[model samples]
Target: MKHKSLAIPYVGWMALFVVAPLILVVVYAFTTREGGFTLDNFSNMVQYAGVFGRSFLLAFLATLVCILLGYPLALLLAREQSRLRGMAMLLIMLPMWMNFLLRTYSWVFLLERNGFFNTLLETVGLPKLDIIGTPAAVVLGMVYNFLPFMVLPIFSVIEKIDPRVIEAAQDLGANSAQVFRRVIFPLSLPGVLSGVTMVFIPSVSTFVISRLLGGGMNLLLGDLIEMQFLGSAYNPHLGSAISLVMMVIVLVSMGLMNRFGEGEGEAVLL
Candidate 1:
């Protein structure tokens, strides 16, 4: 009874904040300024379909890059001794201690035409690379900001894996590659799925990173939605519609990832 009573505040909080806001968004998404029900907001999304496509593509690329880069790093960290492992995890998490916006804005200084890397190349008499205000910059920003999300989850999962299991696989004639391919990789699927969900959801809906890194040249669905509500367009209804769609897409993607992860987990158990 005490535990059940303690849940009352949390339930009230969710109802007041999360549920209420979602309900408001849904209401606004399906209504006009004149308070009449309509489907025009969804119909208008067709014109911005390209933006949505690009957003998802960039997000997918970022998630893939994170997996490729972070998995190896996570494996290395997970293999380290306790003290060394703690230090490595600290280094991975250090960047996150700073404000998220500030961390992202730092990339602006690094990737801009006259930024640090370009200046270094100039001093070295090498041709300066132009990546700012491009899709590449957006992907870079996403990866840089979100890589830790991938690394941490994978590292946690890998660290929890029983060492006896690996030893047993090796005793059964499994080589390092076979052990990883047949055991470690399969066991880490949950972490990979979690990392993907963490990175992809934010990347797909990010406006600040795209705007700051891409210099407004690469507009995403987030940018489009922001424009409707806060930019010169000022169409809250349309913004709500886009937000609702984004929410649905994220929910569906997460469901797919969960299902896929479960199937892989079951296969590995078998």
Candidate 2:
């Protein structure tokens, strides 16, 4: 009874903040401005298919890049001594301590035409690169902000792997490559799933990064949703419908990833 009582506040909090908002969003999504039920809001989504496609594509690329970069770093960090690992983690987390808006805004100055990056290149007698206002810039911003999310999960998982398991694999005449391929990689799937979910969802839904770095040229689903509610679009019903669709897609993607992780774990056991 005490434990149940202790959970009352948390349950109430979730019900008020999370459940209530979701219910409101659903109501708004399925109704017109005059409070009449309608499916036209969802039907209107066809016009913004490009926005959805671009958001998913850029997010996929960013997630892929994070995996390529973060996995190796995580592996290295997991093998390092505690002292070095602590310092490395501090450096990795240092940028996160600052305001997120400020961190993202700082990149605008760095990537703008004739900004720090191009000026540095010019000084080095290299051709100036046009990165800002482009998809590349948006992707770069996503990777920079979300790479830590990818690294930390995998590192935590790899660090927790029992050393004795690796030793047993070696004793069975497994080479370093074989052990990693058969043992380490399979065990780390959960972390990779976690990292992918963390990075992909935010990357797909990020308006600030796309707005600031993309210079208004690269519109994502988040930007579109924002425009609907706050910009000239001014349609909360449409925004809610878009949000609902995006939420459904994200849930489906997460479900597929979870299934894949479970299948991989089973394969390893077999």
Candidate 3:
């Protein structure tokens, strides 16, 4: 009874904040400004297919880049016995301590035409980069901001693996590569799945990164949604519809990832 009473505040908070907002969003999504029920909001979504495609494509690219960069770093960190590992992790997390907008705004200064990156390249007698206001820039921003989310989960899972299990594999004459491929990698699927989810969701729905880095040329789904609610459009109904669709798609994607993870686990066991 004590536990139940203690849980009541949290439950009430969820009901008031989460559930209530979701319900309101659903109601708004399915109705017109005057409260007439309509499906036009969903029907109108077909016109924004390009935005949806571009958002998902950029997000996928960002997630892939994060995986490539973060996995190796995480593997190294997990295996490190020196104090340098702590320092490295701190460095990785340092940028995250600052405001998210501030971090992204700093990239704008670095990636712009006359920005620090190009100026440095010019000083070195190399051709200046013109990647800002492009999809590439957006992907770079996503990777920079979200790479930690990928690294931490994988590192946590890998660090927790039983040392004896690895020793047993070695005792069976397994080479380092064989142990990693057959044992460590399979066991790390949960972390990979978690990392992928963490990176992908935020990347897909990001507006600030796209806005600042893409310089308003590349409109993503998040940009569209934001425009509807807060920009000149002023259409919360349409925004809610878009949000609902995005939520559904995200849920489906997460479900598929979970299934894939389960299958991978089973296959490794077999």
Q: Model 1, stretches more than 4 Å misplaced?
A: 263-270
In order, candidate lDDTs are 0.90, 0.92, 0.91
Q: Model 3, range 51-141, lDDT digits (tens) per residue?
A: 9899989999999999999988988999897999999999999999999999999999999999999999999999999999999999999
Clashing residue pairs found in predicted model 3: none
lDDT tens per residue, model 2, 1-270? 657888989999999999999999999999999999999999989999999999999999999999999999999999897799999999999999998899999999998888998999999999998989999999999999999999998999899999999999999999999999999988888788888888999999999999999999999999999999888789999999999999999888877777878765332211
Error of 1 at 72 (Å): 0.4
| Per-residue error (Å), model 1, residue 206 | 0.6
Give each model a TM-score.
0.95, 0.96, 0.96
Better-scoring candidate (TM-score), 1 or 2: 2
User: Candidate 1 residues 1-270, lDDT tens each?
Assistant: 758989999999999999999999999999999999999999988988889899999999999999999999999998887798888888988999999899999999988899999999999999998999999999999999999989988888998999999999999999999999999998888878778878888899999999999999899989988998889799999999999999898787777767777665332211
Q: Candidate 3: deviation at residue 96, Å?
A: 1.0
Error of 1 at 63 (Å): 0.3
